[model samples]
Target: MPGFVHLHVHTQYSLLDGAIRLDPLIQKAVGFGMDAVAITDHGTMFGTIEFSEKCQKAGLRPIIGMEAYVAPRTLADRTAQDNKELRHLILLAETDEGYRNLCKLASIAQLQGFYYKPRIDKAVLQAHHEGLIAFSACLHGEIPRLILSGNLKAAEDAARWYLALFGEERFYLEVQHNGIPEQTTVNEALFDIADRLSIPLVATNDCHYLEARDVKAHDVLLCIQTGKTIHDSERMKFRTDQLYFKSPEEMTAFFGHRPHTIENTAKIAARCQVDLGFKGYHFPRYNPPGEERSAEEIFEEQVRSGFEDKWRIILQKNPDAERSRYLERLDYEIRVIQEMGFSGYFLIVSDFIRYAKTNGIPVGPGRGSAAGSLVAYCLSITDLDPLVHGLLFERFLNPARKSMPDIDVDFCINGRESVYKYVVDRYGGGEYVSQIITFGKLMTRAVIRDVGRALGIPLKEVDAIAKMVPEVLNISLENALKQEPRLAEMAQSKPEIGELIDICKVLEGLPRHASTHAAGVVIS
Candidate 1:
């Protein structure tokens, strides 16, 4: 049997569409005796870092990739009458440059090309195609779609275009056997195109789940994603049970007649090598107007200047204010920040917060552990004085913690965009400054209601069942069943109820969707 690698795979990071969790994915890959696995989460790279770390720890190669959405036209074209044609494409990072290019593509798709999905046009692809390997993806890929539409000529043209763009060695014609009849048809035409163009044929399962037994739960996940009942005949469905991660032996057997299909996957896996080398801080550079001094120098100067103003306020509030004590605390905090190489971080936060205040944008004094920092108070990043409030600066930024300082500032709803705009303008363009992406997981209560709905349970009954899960942070269905015996009784008494809870257990904590984090922003 030829060795096969899963070059097209999805994890829970693919949101509601995929059911494979990362930890189990690693375990299964090791158990299957595979040396490498790929994570091609749909239109996103949210799981790349975590996947890479876990795979490395498990002694397997992690091929960081994305199943990208390609727009038929320009990213900016969103006219109502326009086709807004979208197709799937698989992209793998073969080098650090490839990883960087993948990041650019993901960001551009989200920031500029987002329509029904985050998308990129061929123009952007032509520019960012370097250091990346291209696969025609599953049946939803451009070439396959064209072939299915009886445009074999067009499909061949698309194949040639990708061949030229990614070069002979970097491009491959992807074939999959997901038990979908179209896949068989698509593979036949894909083989012809590969032969005519001298491109290689690679096989993938287009795995959405970990095992065959996971098909039902994964199907319910799709139902939850589409907000449809499983009984609905017209509901979107995978139409096959074969979209599960298969072992090398199983894949080799499936493509026995075309052994090279199995061999090419291993070849691709061997060629893919991406190291993110995540270490150290790349803080945004902050320079005070007309000051050539280092961030540390400027940071101290600004803190002291601002402290003088704060001192006057303190003296007014309490005539017996301990100036020496306050100064000592401020010195300690500044020293810690400077020594930790976070002076630029402090300056950057201070600059934006100051901008919000000067521009009459209502800003919260400060919140969270950041309110405990004397440096923040003196810098005007916070209004509450740590000494007066008896707050420990160690809670915010400690010398021993060796972590980035997190300062949470609340801006008025109407003016939040202005603050973000100011930060981007001051630090760099949109490429350097972007909001952080966050995932919303399927928690206990939500999952119960979602699974119940997809199972065609009445709304009132679903609501009652979901409420029994208890209102707690990060509770699980099993815990809910244990905590509330009445819920467990219902699950035991009714076959449907037991099924709903069983499915919910499989999906709980899986990411349901992705959205921008309200306050989290990355500047580098």
Candidate 2:
């Protein structure tokens, strides 16, 4: 039997546009007997780590890819029209090199190429084309748009350019069937170009949801994204409901005439193998000039020196406290930290905290389980002494459990930026460090308001309806409606309210926006 794979999948990380959640999506793929699946979310790799982990757990090979928005001109050009005319390009990481390049491209897109969307131009693609497999995306892809515009020569020229950039073996002609009339035209042209150019044709569904029945829910999500109602004819929508993840049998039935296209998906899936370094921390190395001490040695020296300072202060408050117990606890923590290869992480964090305090930045007293570590107290990472407070070292970090130690540090709001700047300057520069990305999801109250506004409901009515939802964490609209009978009664009585509630139910829990993480910074 010829196995089939879905090479183009969009999870909820596609923001408001994609309706499929990661867990259910991977489970469905496994249920369908799929050995491999790909996640090509829009413009960001935010879900890559989660998707990869879930897929691996489900016994499915995870393909890390992104459906990138390509700028019409240079990424530096942010003219309104230039931003508006961005196209689609799909890049899949095939190896470790490809994964690194994918990360670089994604980071650069967010940091530098962000206009209306995080976009990359051809130059950026050419620069980071190594170890990546390129796919001419859907209707919005450059070649297909040119083909639809009747510029067959230009389309061929564009295809040739990509073929040259990503070698012929690595670049593929992607064809999708969503029952759109233009798709037929594009597929025909793509076949002709592929035959002439010696490029393989890979069949994909452009899946945005798990099953066929999810089309309505996915459509409602699109309406939420565009701020339009289902009644609005001019709003963006799929031409047909065939865009969901299809089983191998269904895909073969759809494209049986060209079995090779279906088979190519499996072939491509086999080629892409990414190893995400899971459960591993690559902490930055702290190299103090003219010092030969290892990170562990440096850390021990600092801990001893800092303890002398802390011990003097402790004697003034309680002169009878035993020093031997504190010393034993600190020695145990140092052994555990060194064995775990986290000595450098502790050293790096303490250095920054010291810098902040010496330069007049207000630091918070130790909070979280991290206050339980005696080493942290000695290093001045926290102001509280663990021994005097009888804080357990195992609470902060345990040899029984293997996980990274999370130390929450609070700095004054205004001084936070200065601390970050100092770390960046001390480490290397902006090129070596970048802020982590964070996502905002469409919560229960916000979804109700958004759907109400999009449906042209009055603000007062929306506010009243939203107030019916409880403030419980992770509460769903269904649960809220069950708890508050008025909401169910209103939905049953009024058609508009019923429609708004239905749409909001589908749009709930989807990602609404993205921003930089508050306290996370990565240095490499």
Candidate 3:
């Protein structure tokens, strides 16, 4: 198998736009004894941190990167209120500095350069290229377009310019073979250019879907993206079914004639040592004026003052009940949080929630575990007082079950960004806060549908068969066949149908994608 590691890979975080799921990719990499794998999702680094952790857990190295669009100018100009097409390049973060640069580059592209695609120009690249690796990516790259136009010399010059921009050792010329005629031509010219510049060569599968069978499902995705039906004459199409995560044996067979290309993958992984540690606090902290006090102290002052204010309002509103009960509950809850070593946690939560209320972000009263805390209610961290709402304090911060207090605050969807920004601007740096990363897995139904399409089956039939499968998390084909009388009857009635169903049932539920989870944040 040589030293092959998948470099240009995508996961579901490419958002229904890519096919490779997580479990199988990790399994394949670990099973094959492959050292590392990279996920360069189109235009986003959303999967970078999640992929990093999963690969590490799987004992496979994860290279964090993104396949970013190269804008024609600075980010703001490109994403102005106009549609535009731009060249693409692959960027991999080789270190933490590289990861930060990648995040900044991606943020700028989306925030400023997002007219048609998130893009950045040469100026952005030159500024953010530190600790990063670059590749003259797929046929969509500037260099590949030049080569295809039969301007080899100009392509060579373009290659040199990229090398200069990203540093000679940091840049490589990519060669992919999806059985496209133009790819072969591009490969030949790229090889020639690589030799001239003495830059390394990397082999990638450009895996948009997981298996050969997914070619058609991906085609369907292309249709979905273009708002065209399968039968539309102008629908976009891939040149080959070869754009899948081929097994090491299949890849070995495909490029067995050229060992150097395959070996280059391992070489690149060895050089890419980006360590993504789980940084703490998804929320940024509020800094007090003139360094007058630490975040912790300031937070405590706010919580105590807020608690007193809220307590006065509550007692005045309800003068009938014995005050001892409320006082006793508060004492118990505060003691539990203090013993759990999460008073700071309470302080942090109270601070931002108070800020949100002050700034007019409509926060949910309280949700999930935080609904039961008397301290939370007193501090205005939750609108519903536990006793008043018939909620048990143990449901939130259980004395018997010591764990981090789960305080989830929901804000209006439109203002979540400002809330998140407030958190970032106040809390994090080298020590305080960063985004929590997540991974989405490729499951059975998608793999089955994707595989069926790649084999070039009729769309109506595939859609019908898929519909027979229930719309639940990880629904099984066996269950679908059993539950769907028509599907079982079709399998029994038609031989080809039986084989197709059998093949898909087996391939279903394998890793299909990697994506961020909505509304889940973790702090460490």
lDDT of 3 at 311: 69
| Tens digit per residue, CA lDDT, model 3, 297-366 | 5545555566677667777878785567777876677667666666667776776777888989899998
In the range 1-524, model 2's lDDT, one tens digit per residue, is: 45899989989999888888898889889998889999999999989988999999999999999999999899878898886668899899999999999998998898789887888889998889899998999999999999999999999999999899999779999998789999999999999999998988889999998878778778777877887877798999888898898888988888888899998888888989888888577788989888898998998889889889999998999999888977888789989998998888998899899898998989998999999998899898999988778889888899988679999898988788988998899899988877888888888999888877777799999999999997798899999999999999999999989988887776788888888898899878
lDDT leader: 1
Q: What lDDT tens digits, residue by residue, belong to model 1 across residues 1-524?
A: 44799999999988899899999999999998899999999999989989999999999999999999998778878865333357899999998899999999998887788887888889999999999999999888999999999999999999999999999889999988788999999999988988878999999999999989889999999999898999999988988999999988888888888899999988888988877766677677886578789998989999999999999999998889899999899889989989999888888888888898999999998899999998899889999988888999999887887987888889999899999998888877886788988888898988888898999999999999888877777877888888899999999999999999889888999998778898888888
Query: For each candidate, what TM-score against the reference?
Result: 0.87, 0.94, 0.76
> Which residue pairs does candidate 1 place in steric collision?
none
Query: What is candidate 3's CA lDDT for residue 284?
Result: 34
Candidate 1 whole-model C-alpha lDDT, 0 to 1: 0.89
Error of 1 at 243 (Å): 0.4
Please say which candidate is ahead in lDDT: 1 or 3.
1
lDDT per model vs. reference: 0.89, 0.89, 0.74
